[model samples]
Target: MHIPRWAIPAAVVAASGMLLTGCGKVPPGQQANVGVGAPQAVPDPARQDPSAAPSQSAAPTVLRVAEAARLGKVVTDAEGRTLYRFDKDTARPPASTCLDSCANTWPPVTAPKGRIQVDGVDRNLIGKTKRPDGLWQVTLGGWPLYRYAEDDGPGDVKGQGVGGSWFAAAPDGKKAGGEQQEQDDGDGNGGGRNRWAGWTVVKVRQHPRLGMIVTDGEGRVMYRFDGDRPRVSNCDGQCAKTWPIVKFTNWKKLKTEGVERSRIGFIERKDGSCQLTINGRPMYYFAGDRRPGDANGQGARNAWWVVSPRGEKITG
Candidate 1:
């Protein structure tokens, strides 16, 4: 862990106002457009007009739990927003490939006649799943659950992993942040082994149109290098083979939250190893962004982008 550059832009503006609360302050590169196309049915303030009264027909579909300091509890809705899951969608028999405009940008969390309302969750892992317009939706362990129309408030997880197959939603149904989990070892023969242990060596991941940035520990996407400076690192060799460098063997078990353990530092490259770094720039990873949220190198030629934990950059 090295971080320096005067503590990388006020610890990325105090971890981007603590992982983007309400997310409306927009600035460095604009924000709020997230993930781009396909998902546009907006309008459902819990479906207005039930005679339009009791606070517009009582808009509280209930199903709570929220704490997200890098994603802990999560799973919200009785007006608390944040709820997602859809790695192409499928949970045993529960399915929902995010239809029509991706179900108008991930809406389906309906309870309809199922009349939902659970607090700390676990009503036998909450169930329900039929959407194809048949409504129903809301399922917990069997997956199916949604929200994120670019999430505006209520503990806003900004839809956590967005296009990397969305995430955020764990009250046992799994996927509330931390990410990278593979571990199978039981001899089932799937041969697993990718684990960041307790995870979070750096957080914030979302990009419907690039609303949140900074990733790592398997969620990938992390760049920055306006031609380098502070701790210096002008690419190197074929630009470090398309842009690899983002190392950190242990760094004392690094496990950043919103980011800012003094901005976290470590440079020393030229091949002698030791790369990482945030406020002092020098972070990379874009061999064309093979998977995990892929930023494709954000703005690339204009000098790369995607940093923001308040360290700015982001580009668009």
Candidate 2:
């Protein structure tokens, strides 16, 4: 898939353990980049660089962050796997480099063309895109849907904050470009200066099913996956037969209790119709996500991970 310069900063607390969508959101202004010091890249585990601390340099003019804890939610697959969020993201770029043979390592969430519910999230701004293969891809507010190839096994977060251009999607599930969260007053360990380094702007999103899933007593989405990261996506044309798009014709018609207005949104496609993009990525009914809460796609790739609304992993 192609990466779009304008991506979603959707921080997710995935209820499932799988990291497919587990692979995670948005482009914030360049000023508040995650690291104040130079960002070093290390591919192999042996070469993993130690995480750098934020410098006490001048703060960025605008610091985009996840919504406060109160407004956040969480998601989990049926089997009780945990999820987390990626702290980084880039501008709107729709092309995803993980495809073809690489896609075997990470499967894309697939769904057919349709209309999306636009009850709360700015539905008017939702849009869609068409790939070179003529396949219609959904866009939230404009951010395209994609899967991460590096995410192996369910709940693996290898894709978290890659290139500082990507991030783990939030529970809200919609790719929204709303205002950034305000900085906390208590920043410094001592007296006056704000501990800008410790404060992180969790990129988040709002998907259609985030807060709408059938939950357990403790409110966990159940996820079950039989593979690991770097594994091949077993579902293909025919394999995808069982898992379909959980589509709805009109947002005005459905009646969901306790669901937030901002949590719901729409995505438009090339067919002139619209679909749903959770938090900002496209939503797909996993062919194997059977039994209403099953997350069969977790761990297919190492980059996949889930998140909570408050920016934590979704656990029982």
In order, what is each prediction's RMSD in angstroms?
17.9, 23.8
**Per-residue C-alpha lDDT of model 2 across residues 137-220, encoded as one tens digit per residue:** 433323333445565544544554454333333334332222132221111122343322322112223224443232211222
TM-score, model 2 to reference = 0.24
Q: The CA-based lDDT of model 2 is what?
A: 0.29
lDDT of each: 0.63, 0.29
Instruction: State every prediction's TM-score relative to the real structure.
Output: 0.27, 0.24
Candidate that scores best on lDDT:
1
Model 1: lDDT to the true structure: 0.63
Question: Per-residue lDDT for 214 in model 2?
Answer: 23
lDDT of candidate 1 over 204-298, digit per residue (tens): 55567987677774668888888887556778889888998877443444554345444555554534455666666667888998877778878
